[model samples]
Target: MSAIMSGAISMGILAWIWANLSAAVGVSTWAGFMGTTTYYASGERFIKGWVKGMIANMVGVLWAIICVEVSKVLHVPNIVAIMTGVISFGIVAEAKWKNLSFVPGVYIGCSTTFGMLALNGTYLSTVVALLMGSVVGLLSDAGGELLVRLTNKKETEENLVEKQG
Candidate 1:
């Protein structure tokens, strides 16, 4: 089977599992999906990509929280807007660090955090869901690779047998 087909199958299965698991845990299913998407979009190896994406996401959440707190303290009409602008700058600026270079992950995390807060979701739950989703992403990639390797091995064996016959 082609790598794309194998990956699609793996992703589909893992996404279904993540959706069910996130719902059972009372977390945001969409957040989990976002996490998985971020993992794949990261474009690094498994461990490196997962770590960088998670760190960037948590930093985004922290920035959003800081923006909220600063907005509350400033007492200005546009404090929220100002703080958002500042925090956004900080979020993108952190890409100077090699580990937090995944700017999209940071943005996704920030947006998801804001959405969760609006819906009265806890930070802990958000983190948990993201972590689980990242795990799913890792598993899905591994599973797809495994499938491809097994298929290739079988094909090679069959080809060798045919040549001998």
Candidate 2:
């Protein structure tokens, strides 16, 4: 099967088993798509981008949950949630981190935060769902990597057989 298909299958099974995991499913799907595209570019680049994207999604979701939880504890107005999310993004953007250079980490944080808040999800559940999503994305990437390797091996074997026969 194709790498994208592998990722979809992995995430699909996760979503089917756990309804809450759907929160991260959209990001996971994109990660799978990006992974497949990167693989076409080069195997090394695929692995690097896939890992970085998954990590960024996890960090972003965590940061967003933190902001939302803080706002809830402080009894702040709903507007504060937006401010908190944007500020969190700024902090992440300015921070000195190698992985931050790739992936839309800030956007991920902002969107996840706002989306969860808009949905009126509790702090704990929101965090749990988002974390699960990130893990699923990572798993999907690994599946994609395995598919690529298997495909390459199969092609090599076919080429050898053709040359011999």
Top-lDDT structure, candidate number: 1
Q: How many clashing residue pairs appear in each of the predictions shown?
A: 0, 0
Worst 10 residues of 2 by lDDT: 34-43
User: Which tens-of-lDDT digit does each residue in 19-121 have in candidate 2?
Assistant: 4434335333332233233232222333464456545545655666666566667765675757675666665675577755443543454455566667664
Tens-place lDDT per residue, model 1, 21-125, is: 788878789888778878888887578888877887887788878887788788988898888889889878988988777889999788887888888887777
| Pairs that collide, model 1 | none
Native RMSD of candidate 2 (Å): 6.4
Q: Over the full model, what C-alpha lDDT does candidate 2 score relative to the true structure?
A: 0.53
